[model samples]
Target: MRNKIRIPKRPVDTTMSKTTIPVFIYKPEILRTDRSLVVKNHTVKPVLRTLLFVLTLICITSAAGAQTAEELFNKGLESFKWQKSEEASEYFQQAAQADPNRDIYYLYLGIIYHQSGKLQEAEESYSRGIGLNGGERDRLLLNRGNLRTAVSDYDGASSDYSAVIDAGGPLSSSALLNRANMELNRSSFLLAVGDYTEYLVREPESPQKETIEELLNLLNTRLASDAQAAATAAEQALLEEERRLAEEAARAEEEARRAALMEEALQSLSSSGEDTKSISAGSENIREDFEDSALED
Candidate 1:
């Protein structure tokens, strides 16, 4: 009996969100110019006050419009935690642009983009963070792998998971499970079995332990059935070959028997011809003796 192994689908939540969503609320810092104006005359003092009020208004506007990169990232985080993905994405994009060197900014951007279902953008953001040598390299790879898997890029997803596993960290066990699922999707049952087994070993207390065990059992059963079928097919082929050889041997034996009978018949015919010639010679000698006796009389 064939057993069907049903691999579970990946959750829609971003990999970073699955780990933890930290909400950071930092006050935005605004840049303002402090200009010291000295009015020599009393008449110019009123004008200076008016000019100061205008400068204060301008500063307020600047403070409202311009936010520091850290502030934007914090806002993005808070928005993401609140499930405001669009708002979070905007803030993350702004933060990344303002502080291009910061890996965390791109990381959040990737997460937001992934949550928003913008796969291409999410991949680009993750790649950017990886290129920057982010401290959360494993997290980036995991998120990218998840995205790649969603898009049916099984090979790329496997590579990303393999990298995370090779790095050997807290996320390695998670990578193992994810890569196993991807392998299953690719119909690589043996590879999936190995990864699932390794993951279970590493994470004995994992929440997915029971489910993974069931899947492993099913896979094992399927593999055993396949092996049995292959063995049966090979045995059948061997029997057919034996039957064909036996038929050929039987035909050769029959041909040899027929050739022997033909040779025996030819030898008998040759012996009969020789006997007939001897009889003829005897008859001729008898006639000659009679003729000689008559002539003498």
Candidate 2:
């Protein structure tokens, strides 16, 4: 037999002007009144053991067979709050299978997989959640973009970020920032600068404002230096072309001057030859006249 320990109820207070103060009575039920009595009650002990076993079996059966999706999701939340990731993952998976249309189940499952380093599964889960086109779409896209970035899939990450930006919501600024980072990874400095600037415009009071501003300043300085270098190279090329043209002109002028001098010398020699011919002819005529006079004498 069991023993019951009873606590007496409180009486009315005499000093409180006939006030009735209610007090709770505690009743404690003891399974054993004495150790020697329990040792003699072997039949009672077996019944108690059977009752505990049946209760535990019923609890397990109900949990495994009769729980709804919402109940499972709540249980998952409790496990997640306690940092029991594996247990939470099991519950979330069950919840998602039970109700495939619910976005939150897949969302939580994706987050759990991501934390567990199951990247492919996490990506698939996020994609499913995004396909539902619910309120968590931006969140899913953002997470998937981050996962793609981790795997060096810059193109996919950029696409996801661009989608989020085009949606034009609270996450647009974050999308801009993430896309800027992806562009930086791809070595697209100009694109990165544009995205970063847009992010700053959208989120003027962002917590990362100072850091982003410093990076932008450095990028601007580098771009300016590159522009100056390109301009200098173009100027040098133009100067080289001009120098080559000038040298060609000088050579042409010198050739023309030498050709004029040669023509003048040829003309002088021809005129002197004509004058000698005339002088020779006149001497011949004079000699002939002298010879005729000598013969007559």
Over 186-270, each residue of candidate 1 has an lDDT whose tens digit, in order, gives 8899999999999989999989899999999999999899889999999999999999999999999999999999999999999
- Please give the CA lDDT of all the candidate structures: 0.80, 0.81
Model 2 score (lDDT): 0.81
Clashing residue pairs in candidate 1 (N, C-alpha, C atoms within 3 angstroms): none
lDDT of 1 at 213: 98
Model 2, 231-291: lDDT tens per residue? 9999999999999999999999999999999999999999999999999999999999999
- Report the error of model 2 at residue 92, Å: 1.0
User: Which candidate number maximizes lDDT?
Assistant: 2
Q: Candidate 2's error at 246, in angstroms?
A: 10
TM-scores of the candidates in the order shown? 0.61, 0.59
- Model 2 TM-score is 0.59
